[model samples]
Target: MAALGLSGCSSSEDGGVLTVAGSTTVMPIAEMAAEQFEEETGTKVLVSGLGSSAGIEAVQNGTADIATSSRGLTEAEAATDLVTTVVALDGIAVIVNDDNPVSGLTMDQLRSIYAGETTNWSEVGGDDLQILVVNRDEASGTREAFKKIVMDGTPFDRSAAVLPGTGQVRDVVSRTAGAIGYISIGFVASDFTSSTVKSLAIDGVAATEENVENGTYPVSRDLYFFTKGDPSGKVEDYIELVLSDEMSQTIRDAGYLPLSDASYQARAKAAGAEEGGDAS
Candidate 1:
């Protein structure tokens, strides 16, 4: 989908406006913050989920004021002077349909499955069913993170059906037996323990928030907000609200790791130390 445009009055009297575009994984957090921000101040925050690459491009082209991403910038994108902020922490959950008897897979087995070398569930200890691998589209930050953390240097199977959003991947896997896909841990629950799909453990480790916090989860990542240099005026104010203590509970309620969490604090420091540019 195309990025969302700024809507409503642009005048300061209307409380100003800001546009956010990026990862679907980060969209829920941004949307929640936007509502609270609008209620607290009169500013109109327009948010969209067009994938991480699109969001970064929107900021570079002056179409968006802020960009949210689920993965770190590439060497080329990092050279563009984009200032990064670690907004939250998350884990990528590998999911299958509830009917599937298989519970977990080793890291090597997972890599092999996605790489198309393990085409049958029986190869990994399940029923004698053909494995249907679902994947995210190229623009997805989740896909990039998966490639780095799970696939390592291996390419995805050409036979996999690549969809565009987290929801699509989740839905497809939920209905098709033997289908498997990965998505943010926050998106795992329809209502915490009541999801239609089942999250599988990796290397005998469950995909839980606690596992992510202790650094045991095999596929954890930091969620980000990128700004073109330092933000100022209303844009700055809105970001401050999102990062503030008042928003911590809102973030937690939405199933994300808020900045107040000790685990996120540690991850944030490391990410901050590695960044060296601002978006121009």
Candidate 2:
């Protein structure tokens, strides 16, 4: 996907506009928040899902007011006068076709499967079929997080099909009988009844918001929004709205864990401190 271009300044001169671009995982939540913000504050918010790397670049190049990332920024990116606010928590759920009888997987099993060490479903107690692996492209934050949390520097199978975004991964896995892919837990339904893809529990611990928040879920990570510098005006307002209680239900509905008061306060304090230091 291409970067979303902003009209004028990050905030328009008229009613104001906020441009957000980045992670497909964060796109849905940002769109929902943008819609609410536009209705409530009359500010036009443009959001795009061009991948996390593109989003970071957009912010760095002053093309976007905010960059929404599913993974945390690296130290190099953080050093470039950027401020990241943790807007929500997400769990990376390993998903498979609903028709698959296998329910859960151990971390070691997961590692082996992705690493090309296990090629058949029967190797892990499933039907006798070749396991088709689907993976995100290198630019995807989801893929990066999955590697860090699950693969532990191990590479994906050479034969794994590399797709661009979470939607593609989910769609592909849902239809392919022996296929498996990982995505943000929010992409999976809270309940499996309505989903074509089913999220697997890692080591018997379900990927629930409560589990992610409690640090029991094995594959959870923080979702972030990055600004080129201290957020002000419409950018600040939009970030505040995302972290507010009003958006808690939206966060849940989007399949993410809303930040607690303590988390929210800590992010706010950290951003404030960074801004203060930058001014000095």
Candidate with best TM-score? 1
Residue 175, candidate 2: Cα error in Å is: 0.7
lDDT by candidate, in order shown? 0.85, 0.83
Model 2 Cα lDDT, one tens digit per residue, 1-280: 2225443444443437778999999998899999999999988888899889889988898778888888777778867998878888789999999999899999999999999999999999999999999999987888888888899988788889999988888889988999999999888763533457888989999877667766678998778899887888778889999989999888878888777546544544565587573221
lDDT minimum window of 10 residues, candidate 1: 6-15
Residue 259 lDDT (model 1): 77
TM-score of 2: 0.88
TM-scores of the models, in the given order?
0.91, 0.88
lDDT of 1 at 77: 87
lDDT of 1: 0.85
Error of 1 at 67 (Å): 0.6
Model 1: which residue pairs collide?
Answer: 81-278, 81-279, 82-278, 82-279
Worst 10 residues of 2 by lDDT: 1-10
Candidate 1 local lDDT, 193-233, one digit each (tens): 33499899999999998888777889888888987777778
